[model samples]
Target: MASRRIDVRAVSKDPTGQVLRALYAYASPDAGAPCTIEHDGRSIAAREGEPIALSLLGAGVDTLSRSVKFHRPRGPMCLRGNCEGCLVRVDGEPNRMACAAPARDGREVRSQNSFPSAQLDVLRVTDWFFPKQFDHHHLMVRYGTTINEVMQSFARKMAGLGTLPERPAEAPLPEEIDCDALVVGLGPVGLSVALALAGEGLSVCAVEEEPFAGGLVRDSLQWHSRDGERLCGAEASDRDLAKLRAAGVSVRLSASACATFDDGTIVIQSDRALWVRAKARVFTNGCHESVGAFGDNDLPGVYTARAAARALRYGVRVGESVLVCGDEDPALDALSDALSAVGAKVHRLTEGERLLEATGSSSVSGALVGRDERSAHKIKCDAIVASTSRTPAFELAGQAGVEAAQDLDRQCFASWADELGRTQRSDVFVAGSVAHGGRSPVRESAVARSVRDYVTKGRVR
Candidate 1:
């Protein structure tokens, strides 16, 4: 199937009813090679390098997975792996993340935690039967001992991600590496820090959880980076990623740094464990996007604003009629306009307006929104894009002995940092969104310089 073309520079203000929930050719996206994959015994064709979620959704498979307990419908809420909505079994591997895993020819994708099929899961009756909550422990005890045991057994079988892998896989021995500075993310800020440290002749090793190095900045669609890069969206990330490689900075992709020790050792996990001991550690890890409580909040069509926008690069229209809500993120404006460009009616709830409830059975069909209790009204929409305060990813740094406190004004957990990104821990520093300034060029650059200076003064030891 062919796709409709939408350009960021020349987007139309008028909504056109031309999109058909199929692939769209976003302006000059250097698309990957076409490949085929098997989904639940059916064949699907999509770009080779695109994520499994995009490939499956483009093939008209909407219900990706069923909720564990209630069996409510679920789909890709976050194109990134932060949300657990897109979990699926792949090639006999249980609980593989569809949004993070890339598509390959002959790869088998199947929905898990559903009986027979995700589309027609009879298990969803549990949602209706127990409108409040299902107390499995005391559910059948009133009947008898035998009946209670049986109910417990059924509940046990119904829970969990999926069965074990096809076979037990062998574990590899951990690998160890040494570097002058360890940068934990590869977003525009992370890349800038890595490049700056490398320029000072320090050995830098940057680790990114995404399969590719560039971060969500590229996914902003229309918003540009204010990090003094003067580049917008994909251009900023593309150039910085190239620079990181040319400068000989070792970058490990699709890996996460799991732990940090007092002795300056960090453990990273991927296919294999990596023990990295660096003189200084800089965390540029970004924040997490979230949504608020509402009716059928976990429905298949509810997506974080940035998450839905990220899929557009690969031509995945989240929904034809989308209700943009919650935080006023800069990216939401671009998302609203981009959706408008491709035949979607974008309804953005302004200040004082809020989403009261999301309506739909399997996926969102409309939303109830209002500025006050008496002002509520329903807007017909197929998708609901929601966002809240961004919580800085600080668990890894906190494990390294840094402190974090929740910001009431911003409603996020922010790390305490001095002028040079110094945390409570002397050897560990933080930058990027993890720090206070929120993705500022000055913040990232100053922290990188501090790391360079510490190493230059032989303070690393």
Candidate 2:
């Protein structure tokens, strides 16, 4: 496959130009510094405060890193940085998720889990020698006595880079947190739910994973209300955070909701562990970015597109030149502009059949972009921010044995419940993105109405 360079004829102005400007403004130097990444022959840079992966993608590097087992090509699957697919070596440390890492200039990156190159990996030969041995059925047939030792030795040899580094654990004192209605996530939908709940004088407890609030709003390319007013969730996020505080709603940033139990009891873990026994819980954890299955998808520089957007929000540069590959849509388009604003040469794979593999050594150097759906073309890049789709954050709900159904209209899985958000379990209720099919708006009013009805009617609908 011959590589293709950006054709001057294909150059076009970004459709999401206005929104990109706003995003860059929000992440300007006054807000913070810029982050940078080096790939191929260029250096991509974005403002500080944005996620490293987002900045890299914005600059147009779609293939951040490669996969491990098959040395198959890979990209960002989840945006919250939980999936190990987007791991990159930062400052010599292995397995740093580009999505979670705040971009900073001078940070060194190296791809992991491959030798010679991520795309042309020599270890892929192992796949040919023991193809059947890696399968689940083969592993299960053997008893532990004979196979355990053999497996352990093989595992030791096959174990690649990016092992989790050991760190000391810190424990904090327990505290009682109270709320009339508790909402998880700080995205637009979550904020809208909080606004509605707070307006009703219901004590709301909202938690966000970022150092700041805004959920997906921070990276929203641009969303227009029915009234036609442009709403960038960044400002709205700040206002929403302020309003929650003013309404006496407790807002916890950098906090994680570890679990939800029966009888409205929730466990939250942050720098400290705490318990919240609220009357009702509004689950708005939203969704994670979807990862791609390919050879060496675990290499450094391979990251999700959302991670690159985070780098832009934080005002950090991800790389010099980035390749943005994904289904053509406003979300992906916005990333191109964001990366360009921060100083990355952006490239987009608009044509659907252009499947390609990200290639590099130590770290990603470029990609083999398929041209016109036929043969492969090459794009010189340092990082690749590739994405497939988003998946709902239903871990807690799934574990609780909540009945989930696929909502084809929304391209996601949803659960059935009454108008007031009651489930089969009398005491359990769901709202926001988790209840709906992971839509952005997620019918904010619906969430509030359900919570309000439950609080007032005092019965499962």
Q: Which predicted model would earn the best lDDT?
A: 1
Q: TM-scores of all models?
A: 0.89, 0.70
**Leading candidate by TM-score:** 1
lDDT of 1 at 29: 40
**Model 2, 1-461: lDDT tens per residue?**
12211222223454555544555446544555545665332476654655566565555454555555555444444557576555777666667777676667766655567655443457667666675656634563467656867776766665776545445445677667877777777776677778888876678788777667776666665653423556565665666677768877788877777777754444544447657777777766777765365444455566677766655554444566788877555777777775675557887775554546767744577877665435777788776777775667767666556777686766777654555556665434566566654443345666676677776676544
CA lDDT of every candidate: 0.77, 0.62
**Candidate 1 error regions (>4 Å):** 1-30, 223-232, 263-270, 437-442, 456-461
- Which whole-number lDDT from 0 to 100 does residue 277 have in model 2? 70
**In model 1, how large is the Cα lDDT of residue 431?**
81
